[model samples]
Target chain A: MGEFELIERFFKRPARRSPLGVGDDCALLQPAPGMQLAVSTDMLVEGRHFLSTVDPLRLGHKALAVNLSDLAACGASPLAFSLALALPAANEAWLERFSRGLLALADSHGCELVGGDTTQGPLNICITVFGEVPAGGALLRSGARAGDDIYVSGSVGDARLALEVFRGRLSVPAAVFEAARARLEQPTPRLALGMALRGIASAAIDISDGLAGDLGHVLSQSGVGARVDSVSAFGLLASPGIPVDTALDLVLSGGDDYELLFTAPPSASKAVQAAAAASATPITRIGTIHAEPGLQLVDRSGAVLMRRFTSFDHFA
Target chain B: MGEFELIERFFKRPARRSPLGVGDDCALLQPAPGMQLAVSTDMLVEGRHFLSTVDPLRLGHKALAVNLSDLAACGASPLAFSLALALPAANEAWLERFSRGLLALADSHGCELVGGDTTQGPLNICITVFGEVPAGGALLRSGARAGDDIYVSGSVGDARLALEVFRGRLSVPAAVFEAARARLEQPTPRLALGMALRGIASAAIDISDGLAGDLGHVLSQSGVGARVDSVSAFGLLASPGIPVDTALDLVLSGGDDYELLFTAPPSASKAVQAAAAASATPITRIGTIHAEPGLQLVDRSGAVLMRRFTSFDHFA
Candidate 1:
């Protein structure tokens, strides 16, 4: 099939919120008045972002999910997204599964597929997502202040543990492996929690490159330090029976966690809990922002841990 | 350099018209009230889209140029764009030159770099551009009616001719090759003309996958056919000394031409000319829309041409 046929068969949908959608050179979106359009893009290459053994359906879901995670970080409501894909070949079955998974998530979020380009090349999936937020209400990494309470929504480190099993470096029980693999393959973007914390959280970021590394962005941007409870973070790992050191390593440095790490002032503690309850997403207070200029991991007895953890870097 | 450092060193720019650019999970844009956001995305893969031997600068320009051409087709003013790029390695020299070319064109059009993702993989560049048009003012491919005067901005086929030279399929004079190569490497988007033809043109599309194929979209979408003058199209090929058959093939079916192909009413001919003149972009009236449902190519004597031409299709 031709490029147009591929798009028409699998990707095209009638325009809903958009004035024009697929089949147009450009899609037209009218954001509500006084709303700021939030834009983010993520590109996933086969080996770099996903394993070759990954299912096409899961790949599709993960591609859009990662971009949505960015929108979630900004506390933006998903509106629309564009997918630019390059495939090695025009495989009908793979396309069917991929599109089914992609559009399923899109429909659930009310995010319409607007426009994109398809070509013949190495498999690459790039999604640019659009969302809307009230003017000046976007959660940013630079908003954290000293004395702010640091919290993380959902769990982390499970995705990294799943990666280890996939790499054959570790083995786990079948049920545990399946659960961790699911977390790695299909991450849940904390959209509700992000939106709920918009006015409450002083700073927010979705954890992708482990909690410590991603939180480093918040600390550096906000020009503040943080004191993370190492034991508290140890509990963030969902997998059981792992060594303390390895668990801490995965919890602190694992990549592909789509949880949100955010900060709110102590005065907003009650309000933060209320927001979490409203969103039905669990939240855990694991740290506190400090006026100092470095990240400190403290043990249960309040002794600083000397270990260092680095985040994933594409060009490291 | 690490991913964040690479982005900070090269791609990050201060927010200009946008509320945020490049530093956060999402960039925030607030369009003027009553304006529709025009969105388009294009992915350029090495070997498929361009030669590996081509200069990185030209590659960068062509990437953004192609996407801007889409916005132009919709009569939208450039606003902002996000670039998702995957590179095989962190080559500082290449990145410097590429960003220079990309940002130069972006600055020329007043489009800010908002947000995107960078990863380690085989080279792929995906750009998602945003533009703005007044509500109900954006031109579309579904509005062309029978008796509309078909038009083309600038020229076509030269880019394809350049590719032929590169492939050693044809040889031309030094000047001719350079000129054709320029067309291939750095085709200008007819943004001004598209904006000017906002009300004059009934339907429009950017000539990317050759005129015949791209126009087929307008025809199919509008449920109309067209009678294109083969001789008139032959002149669109800027290269001289090429045979009529070869020239016609390139002119009618060549890809990578970022010119505008559009339709306007016979009554609005004068207004179309005025629009073309106001934008200072040359245009040719090459055909007329018909009530019939098949494309017809005619010679100067108005006799139908029996030859068939297929536009570029990635899979085919």
Candidate 2:
């Protein structure tokens, strides 16, 4: 059979009651009146994003979590999403487990699985999430101004640390190792923290490619720079129990933290403090925004220690 | 470097303005005001979707076109899309031309190339398109009623025929072969016809997986069936000089037509006719919706012919 015939035989299925479901030039989704739509997409490859040995369920959760985190970055509430999954072959059990994990997350987030496509290939998964925010109210990276305090929620470097362990470069206590591995296997998307920071934080971004790289994004977008105090940044490493230098490296360059790094003006500090107290996520002040347009790391004595460059160029 | 590091090094570029962009759990985009979101996604594998010998530029166009066709199926106006591209290795020239073809289509359609991820793997492209429709207004498959007439825009089976020629199973005049080959290589997206069918048609779907399979979608969604006049369906084949039986097979089962198939109430027939005339697309009445819940094919004498299932089924 030809490609068209193959598509017909394997890809087309009857859609549910979507107002504009598959078969049109585009699928139309009606957002509730007065709501703004939130959109995000993520791609996961077999050996790249997840080990072939990874559980399909966890893989699925990570996929959805990653996208939902983007929605959380904008403080948008989940609405629906479409999935594009490619697999070497159809495995009913794998699909069932994967779908369960995905649906579990979707159910918790109140997002519907509105549409999807499945095809045969080396395993890859791409999900596009749609959410809703109030009009003109999405938190962005461009809003930070000079004198705003920079903050990162929860911890950083656990995933990267876990990767080091996975690659046999680092060894840790059993409990710490398991914890780090779990962190890598199943990340908690900080949607609540993101939503809470919406109005208070001047700018916000999630730490996926590492703190230094992600912070650069916030700074560059805000047209401002930052001087991150290493002492303050290292404070987040207190519980991780690695050497100060090693911990600093992890925090700086280790990726997949999935935590929110944000900036808030002095006027909003008190509100942020209270919000952090009420939220389960830990928040720490790590730096301050500057008028300059580059990121710098400073020692506690205020000496410039390092100037970091961007991390994780996927194509390069 | 490994895959994860590669993603961090290359794929995670900085985007400060987007609520969620690279280096985050997900990227977030704000839908335009007063517009409902439209979404569709498609995955194209190297060997599955295109031959290695095919031009990268054309491959790129075909990839985008398939997803755009999905958007057209829903009658939504295109806006933006995120792409997840996997390649065995980086090819600068291939990337440039492929991106040019993709961006050219995006520009023409007013869709922005908002976000994407690239990685090392076998060639695979997954694109998720975001579009918009007027709030509270979208064409749906479930809206078709039993008495509605079924109509299709443009000719069908040309792509399938072209594929047959490409496979060396058929021979035709050079001009005819090239015309068919063009249809296979670059199927036109019926965007205008879809937009024009909005409101006028009770239900609409694109014919990507052949007439029978796509019609089955409307029938299932609308809780009705259909009776297609085989004679009328073969009208397009008359000028193509192909055998009637072969043409019928192509019409009934061949896919990738990318034509809009819609059902409208009898009262709106005149309006559909007028819209079809005004549209740059050709519209043909090929069938009628039936109160029954299964499809029926009829010959010129109104006698039922052999019924068969037609369309793509991923798992099957």
Please give the distance, in angstroms, between residue B301's alpha carbon in candidate 1 and its true position after superposition.
0.6
Q: Please tell me the TM-score of chain B in candidate 1 relative to the true structure's chain B.
A: 0.98
Query: Which lDDT value does model 1 have at A18?
Result: 83
* Model 1 interface DockQ: 0.90
Q: Write the residue-wise lDDT of candidate 2 on B1-316 in tens digits.
A: 5544444443344443344455433455555667677788888887666778777777777888888777676677776678888888777678767877776776777766666677777788989887677766667777889888998888888878777778887676788777776776677777777677777888888887788888887898789989887434343354455777777778878887877888999999898988787767888888889898988888879898884546765545
Residue-level lDDT tens digits of model 1 in A173-221:
8888888889899888888888888788999999998889999999999
Candidate 2 CAPRI classification by DockQ: acceptable
Model 1 lDDT tens row, B179-243: 88988988898899989988889999999998899999999999999999744434335446677
| DockQ score of each predicted structure, in the order shown | 0.90, 0.41
Model 2: how far is A8 from its true place, Å?
Answer: 17
